[model samples]
Target: MPPFSRVTVIGLGLIGSSIARGVRAHMTGVGLTGYDADPQVRETAKAIGLCDDVADSAGAAVTDADLVILCVPVGAIGDAAREFAEDLPADAVVSDVGSCKESVVTALREALPGVAIVPAHPVAGTERSGPEAGFAQLFHNRWCILTPPADADPLAVERVAEFWKRLGADIEMMEPAHHDRVLAVTSHLPHLIAYTIVGTASDLEEVTSSEVIKYSAGGFRDFTRIAASDPTMWRDVFLSNREAVLDMLQRFSEDLSALQRAIRWGKGEELFDLFTRTRAVRRSVIEQGQDDAREDFGRAHD
Candidate 1:
C-alpha cells in the first residue's frame, strides 16, 4: 500500500546495485539493504554506498524488508527464495530481476508460499557484470516486463509496478509463458547466435583473427559485444531456460538453412526479400530510439 520503508536486495551486482541507486535517488522514504553471496561484490556495494546497509546473508537483508528483490542468476532464484522464505516479513513483497519469468516464478512459488512473488525482467542489461558496472539510468526508458500470476493481488502488483516506474522503466504485464516465448525469440536466440559466431572467430588463426578484430565494422562486432557477457551467467541462462531456447534455436537453424540455399542457388530475390524484412525491423527499433549508435559501446561498458 504505502511506499516501502525497508527494501532488501539480494545479489548486489549490477542489476541490484542499479536498483539501489535508482531507489536512493527517487524513492525518498525507502531504506535500502543489500546482500551478495560474493564477498567482493558485498564489499564493493558498501564501499560505494549503494545501499543504507549491506548484510552478510539473505535472511538478514530481508528480515524487516517490505520489498525484497532477488538479483542473482536465474538458476539461483529458488535457492535465494528458500534461504529467506521463513524470515520474510509477513506482508513483504518478493520480486526478482531474472531474465526468464516462468522458471523464476516456479522457483519462487515453490519456495515462498503465499508471499507475493512478482517476476520482473528488466530488458536492459549490458555485457558487463558486478556492482561497478551499474548506473542509476540503466533502466531509463527500458521495458520492465512483470509476469504476475492470474490470481496475484492487484495491490501487490501495483506496488511493484510503481517501484519500477519510479526507476524509469516503462512497465508491461504479460503471462509468464508469453513472456518467455517472446524473449526466446527476441533475446535468447540472438545471444546463442552471437556465442556461436564468436566461438567460430576465436578458432581462427591468430593472424587472421587479429585482422578480423581490427576491421569488424557492424554485424560481426555486434555479435562480439553480446558474446562478451559473463560466461557463467549466460551458461546458467541457457541451461535453465533450455526448452524455449532450443525451440527458437531449431527454428533459427531452419531459417539459416533456407538462407544458405537461396545464396547457393543464386536466388537474389529471396535473399533481397529476407534482407529487406530484417532491415525494416531494425528501422522500427531505431524509430523507437532503442537502437542508438552507441548501443555497442554502451553494452561493452555497462
Candidate 2:
C-alpha cells in the first residue's frame, strides 16, 4: 500500500499540479485534492482535471488528507498553514515543496505546532508557471532534499521520504539551516544573478535592444529564461530566504570584484584558472546526472 491514501495539495501552480500528476501516474490508489489561492487557477485546475478534486477553500482540501503538501511560495507557507490549520487532521503529516527550509520549518512549527512538518525542496522545475505547464515526469530523476526537524516523528519522515521516492525522486536528508545555506549558493544566487543581468540588459535596451534580442541566441537567452520565471514567486523566494541569500550575495560580490581586478590587470592566468575550475564543476554536474552533457546545450533535446 502507498504511504498516503490521500494527498492534499495547496496551490495549483506548476509544482502542485506536477505532484498531482505524478501521484496519478505512480501511486495508483492514492487520491489527490488541490486548492489554489486564486479562483481562476482553481477553475483552470478543475477544467484540466489537475486533481481528483479542486477544493474551493484551502481548509476544505485538507479536511481528510493523510498527507497534506503545501506547494505555495516559501513566504506564504505560514499564511497557508494558518488557513488550513483548523481543518488539518490531528495526525496528518504536513510537508511543503518550498526552496528554502529554515524559514519554512520555523513558520510551520509556529503556525501548526504538534503537526508533522517536514520541509522538502524538489530540485526540479523549468522557467514555467501555471498548472498547464507541469508534467508527470517533472520530478523524475530529480533530487528531493528533505529537511526534517530533529524532534520530528521518524515514521512521518520515512513516510514522506517513501512518498517522494514513489514519485521517481531521489530523497536526500539535510539540516534545515544547512539546506538554506547550500541552496543560497546553488539556486538562490544564480537566480539573483540572472535577474540582475537580465534587468541590466533591459535597462540598456534603448542602446542595444535589437542587438540584444538578435544575438541572444544561446547563452544570453538562457539567462533570460531564468530571469523570465514568475516574478512574484522569485520575489517571494528571495525575500523569504533573505539572510542566506544576502550572505551568498556578499561572497559573490567579493568574487566579482576579484574577477574585475584580474581583467583590469590583464591576469590571463587567473582568468584561465577560474574558467578551468568552473568548467570541471560543470563536468561533475553532468557526470552525476544532474544535467545533460550534450553539446547543443539543452536546445536539441527540448
Candidate 3:
C-alpha cells in the first residue's frame, strides 16, 4: 500500500506519539504533522523529530492529510473532530485511537459527513502518559480493533487497516457497539475496580497504609499499577462508555457477591470451583500469549 502521504496526528500523547514513531519508521514517504493542546508535548515532539511539522491547531494539521488520527482523551474526540471537520481533505480518512469506540463514532460521524471515518482502538498501553512515554514498539503484536460504520468506504477501511498493519498491530473489524461492550468487560470494568481498590487502600489510616504498602503482594499491588494510569483518560473512558461499563459492572458485582457469600458461609467446594475456573482463565490468557509472566512489577506501589 502507498504511504498515507500526509498524515495528521491530533493530540500527541502516548498513543499518538507512538503512532508517529511507527508511521515514520514504517511508511517512508509519509509526511507527518502533529497537534496537541499541551504546548510542552508539541514542543517535545517537535524537538524529538516525531513529526515533520507541529501545527498549532487540529485544522492546520489536517489541511491536506490523507489520514487524520485523533488521539485525544475519549471525551475530547468530538470537539477535535469538529475542529477540523470542514478542513479535512476530501479523500482524507479520519480515524481515532480513542479507547472507547461507540462514543467516538457518534462524535466524529456527526462532524465529518463525506470523509471516511474509521474508528480504531489500539489495545496496548503503559501506566505512563504523554509523548515521553511513547515507544515505536507499543503497537507491536498488539490488537488494534477497528469499528467501521456500515456505509464507510471499503477502500478507506482497507487503507486504514493497512496503515495500522504497518505499525505491527494485528487488526480485527467489528461494529462500534460490539467493540464498546467487549472492551467494557475486558478493559473498563477492570480499570474501574483497580481505581476503586487502590483508592480504598489510600484512605486507610497512616499506620495501616504503611503496612498495606509494605505487604501489598497478595494482589492489591496489581490493582495499584493499573490505577496509576492517566486520570483524565480513564475518567473520560468511564463517562463516555457509561452504558457498557455499567452493564459489565452489574455482572461483575453479582459474581463478587457470590464469592463473598462463599467465604461468609465457609463453602470450601464453592470457593475451590470459583478459583479453579478463574485459574483456567489465566491459563488460557497465557496460552494465547497475552499474560504478563514476569511478576516483575509486584512492588511498584502507589
Candidate 4:
C-alpha cells in the first residue's frame, strides 16, 4: 500500500514541485495537491499539471490532505503551517524540507499543536529555483533525514520514511540538534564559503568583474554555481541554524589561520600533507557514490 493517499505540498518551488512530480511518477494512486504564496507560481504549477489540484490558498490545499509537506524557506515554515493550521486534518502528518531540523521541528510543533509532525531534510537540490526546475529524479540517490520529536508517533515517522523511499530516497533517522550540526559542517558551511569566495572576488579592486568572469578557472566557476543559489532560501537557512553554523564557522576560521601560517613560513611539507588528506576525502566521497568520479566532475564541453 502507498504510504499516503493524498499529499499536499505548500510552496511550489523546486523541491515542492519535484515532490509533486515524484509522486505522479512513483505513486499513481496518490492524490497530489499543491499551493504557493505567489499567484504566478500557482498558475505555473497548474499550467504544467504539477499536481492533481492546485489550490489557491494554503488552507484550502491541506483541507483533505493526509500528508502536508511544507517546502517553504526555513524562516517561513511556521507562518506557512499556521496559515493552514485550522484547515489541516486532525490525522494528517505535517513535515517540511528545510535544511535546519531543530528550528523547523520547534516551529511546526508550535504552529500546529498536537499534529503528527515529522521534520525531514531531503539533502538534495540544485542551484535553481521555481516550479520549472524540479525533476522526479532529483532524490534518486539522495539522503532524506527524518528528525521527529521524541514524543512523535512511530507510525507517522515510518510512513514519512516510506514516502521518501518510494520517491527514490534513502532514509536516515537523526536527532534534530545532531542533524543541524552535521549539516552545518557538511552542507551549510560549504555554501557559506562558496558565497564568501565569490563575493570576495567580485569586490577585489585589482580585478574587474568582467576580467573575473572572462578568465574564470574551474574552481571559481564551481564556487559561482554554489553562490548563485537562491538568496532568500539561504538567508533563512543561515539564520535558522545560526548556532551550529556559527560554531562550525569558528572552527573553520581556526583551521584557515593554520593554513595561512603554513603558506607564510614556506612549509611545503605541511601544505602537501593537508592537500593529500583532503584529496583522499574527495576520493572517498566518490567511492561512496555521493559524487561523480569523472574528470571535471562529469562536465561536458563542446
| TM-score of each candidate structure, all chains considered together | 0.94, 0.97, 0.95, 0.99
121-230: candidate 2 lDDT, tens digit per residue: 99999899988988899999999999999999999999999999998999999998899899899998999999999888867946587778788985788898889888
Q: Give Cα-based local distance difference scores for all models.
A: 0.88, 0.91, 0.89, 0.95
Deviation in Å, model 4, residue 124 alpha carbon: 0.7
Better of 2 and 4 by TM-score: 4
Q: Give residue 67's error in model 1 in angstroms.
A: 0.1
* Model 2: pairs clashing at backbone N, Cα or C within 3 Å: none
- Encode model 4's per-residue lDDT on 1-302: one tens digit a residue: 89999999999999999999999999999999999999999999999999999998999999999999999999999999999999999999999999999889889989999999999999899999999999999999999999999999999999999999999999999999999999999999999999999999999998998889988874689999999999999999999999999999999999999999999999999999999999999999999999988978899967
* Weakest lDDT window of 10 consecutive positions for candidate 1: 293-302
lDDT of 1 at 21: 89
Clashes (candidate 1): 0
Off by over 4 Å in 4: none
Q: Compose the digit string of candidate 1's lDDT tens values, residues 122-169.
A: 999988889988888999999999999998989989989999999999
How far off is residue 32 in model 2, in Å? 0.9
By TM-score, the best candidate is: 4
TM-score of 3: 0.95
Clashing pairs in 4: none
Judge candidate 4 against the unseen true structure and give its global Cα lDDT, from 0 to 1: 0.95
